[model samples]
Target: MATNAQLGADDDYIVVRNPSKLADLLTARNVDPEVVTKYLHIIRGDAKDCYTVGKTLYGINLEIADMVVSDVGGSTVVKPNRLRPTLDDPTICQDVVSNIPNSLKRIELLFKATPRTRRKPYIVVISTTGISNHGRDIAVAMDKKAMEGILLREIQTGGRGASVIRGFTAVRPSFLTDGKPVGAQKIRAAVEEEGKVAKSAIGYTISRGDVGAWIYEELVEDNAAGELKYVN
Candidate 1:
């Protein structure tokens, strides 16, 4: 089981939408309820909306350093960039000296400071239907080889924004429908096994509540540690 401390408070989790579901699951499991309330963080965007999802998920930012330039003949010449921490840059030494106290200050600041933006391991929920050619008959359509290909290439590429984190467990669930909580017992989950399909692995339609419970029971509880799993 990964602790909030091991995975920093701010960066421990990267949920996409309806983070409340993950929180609800964690609470039911008797894990630290406050962990979800205080530490569980989310990437703000919709995965379906690819256009701006990356910016929202990663919170893109840019910093421009001041550049030194001189006029050489008719052209403006910019100074060559120097390696950081070189003898020419005394600021690097100063930074090293200052970081110790700053580190201590950061610890103290954690109590009041807004959670810093950092990447950590994540359990990403996605659709098996996205990869399967068949709609409800995805079980037959998704073979072991096809599952591997979708996970490796398609999912990897589409989810590249969240890939910067340590790693992620892609939870490929069957058809999802809104209803009462199905409870963890009703859900079936397994690692990417060849020949596994919707009917053989688990049921076809899974409730959103059950999906949440499965994430907590299987992925989070077992400490999946970055792997792909199918659930229903």
Candidate 2:
């Protein structure tokens, strides 16, 4: 079990797309909900589109920090990605509209590969930004029992965005050239925090779209490790 505070050197930070999933993950890791919530503050209970990038909150440019969990009862798993949404794109109605079908399909596969369990795995979405109408629509669509999960990411009106948005590892780093590293100090800093670090490091690197890809790999790896098991 891992707590929000008890991170090891090799520990990788994760983001989930749902709340109930988050609760379940923390329980498995033996993390206290009060403590987890303390680390996370709710901005908009609803949905909106936006994310905070870096120390300053950015508009459409955003980041998602998450925690992934394995279900105890059922092979179904829940993943939570706490985000800071920004409504910088007024014309667009929101900043980000997550690729819903792709995400759901990934979950669907994970569920099928792992045997059935009493614990129905689902998603738990949290947003520093408010939830958008689109986000809500997606959530509703995903609420089917067969899917039997959720999607709850959004942006808020004006809650304290500082704590909620900080300490997050970006899914992608802003700089990377053929596995070689090249970037400004800020990007370097972000990559170091997000990925594995070396003692005699040459430099830092991260790809923006690579975060999701990496997460997918991790999920499969977890399955291989028996974190995702096959029950009779």
Candidate 3:
């Protein structure tokens, strides 16, 4: 999702990205400088105090966040992205899950710290499309290792360990195409149950922009994608 869009609009965000191209990134996203000051808290790795624009970093930071999003997968940890996965290299199926042990604890604390209010925050993630045996019948189990890793993040994060921070939703899309948004209504979304997201059998592929629209509908427009509890 674009930072200038409703994805980051009027919301306090912990923006973590390659800080070297910070200006170009914002320009590409069409975000104004003022918008950066109004809502974003960038985690500038290494360049000490170069961009300490936000006041808070650790304390109560995760707690107040409106959403906990994880876009990383198995390929996230693999270095030198030029090469494909090899059968010999183990731990390829769960790079993100394995590295997020500390983050899991932090997520739990965020859930626990949730205020006694009507609205609750959500944890959303991008999982692979082959998890429920619905998409790409040809891809072998070994090839879908990244998908497996991503699905693990969704399921594990939805468990009692996190304990009611908000609803959790996982979008397991097939090959992502780049183009104009296909619109969320065009998506044949998988049925969401208590703690499960059934795979969509009919849909073979979805555009990245469509995925963003789907997320906006789920998170912003209240067409939520999972079990929810709106307390009074």
Candidate 4:
């Protein structure tokens, strides 16, 4: 495996020829920045941190390029460019599960172990079951993690295979004015369910409306590749 020191310059850019070389160069034991950067390079981006290099089969951005690198004993720890994960827009279901540890307690443990950066490190759990009608996946893991006082920031229900029904009807509620109204009722139900899921997932109380900003910070605006802007 080719290490970072072995990398060659390609017209002002550093290139790592071998893909597997990155794993060897980076220690998987913890959040290493050097490993993350090498991982980013292996994944490839335009001018480093300009845009995510890979995508999942679902069109989700898989490799987030923007990262904060911390030098740790000849290694680097790479994390989301920003401390938080975004979730405001409702359209982009951030897939942060891969970045998280296996269990819910593992998340809390990891957060406590890692050193704090400029921003507070809060964990946002996105439900991968992909059940939108069940409400946003962000809430479940978020709530579980927040039980320790971490804050559940934002919730979104529904995804590619998810539904957005508003509410449930008890015995049709009068079949007057056409059944088309039922459709609207379902939509409302879905929206309301999303809210409920968000609340349920948080497991703790947050300042009202703050979840929106937290979601936007970690998810949408903090583009991984966008970090190149500061590199010069």
The C-alpha stretches of model 3 lying farther than 4 A from their native spots are 1-11, 15-17, 45-64, 74-101, 104-121, 133-167, 192-201, 220-232
lDDT of 4 by residue, 21-97 (tens): 54564454354765465444343322112122112100121111122211001112334765444444222212322
> What residue runs in model 4 are displaced by over 4 Å at the alpha carbon?
1-119, 122-130, 133-220, 223-232
Candidate 4 — worst ten consecutive residues by lDDT sum?
166-175
Q: Please, what is the TM-score per model?
A: 0.40, 0.20, 0.56, 0.18
For candidate 3, the lDDT comes to: 0.46
Per-residue lDDT tens digits of candidate 3, residues 46-163? 2112222121122232333345444543333335653654444344324433323334344445555554221334555566564553344325223444534454454466574443
Taking the tens digit of each residue's C-alpha lDDT, what string does model 1 give over 1-232? 1233333434332424566775676677688976665754455433333332322222222111011000001112235653322233322222322222232233334423334433333323333443533334453322222323332442255475533233334456666678777688966665544554444555567776787677666655454343334322
Give the 10-residue window scoring lowest on summed lDDT in candidate 1. 63-72
Query: Could you report the Cα RMSD, in angstroms, for every candidate shown?
Result: 19.6, 20.5, 7.5, 20.7
How well is each residue in 130-202 modelled by candidate 2, as lDDT tens digits? 1222222121111122111222221122332411211111222222234432223323221222233322322
Best by TM-score: 3
**What's model 1's TM-score?**
0.40
Assess candidate 2 and give its lDDT. 0.27
Q: With candidate 1 superimposed using the best TM-score fit, by how many Å does residue 124's alpha carbon deviate from the native?
A: 2.8
Top-down TM-score ranking: 3, 1, 2, 4
Highest lDDT scorer = 3
Backbone clash count, each prediction separately: 1, 39, 0, 34
- Model 3 weakest lDDT span, ten residues long: 47-56
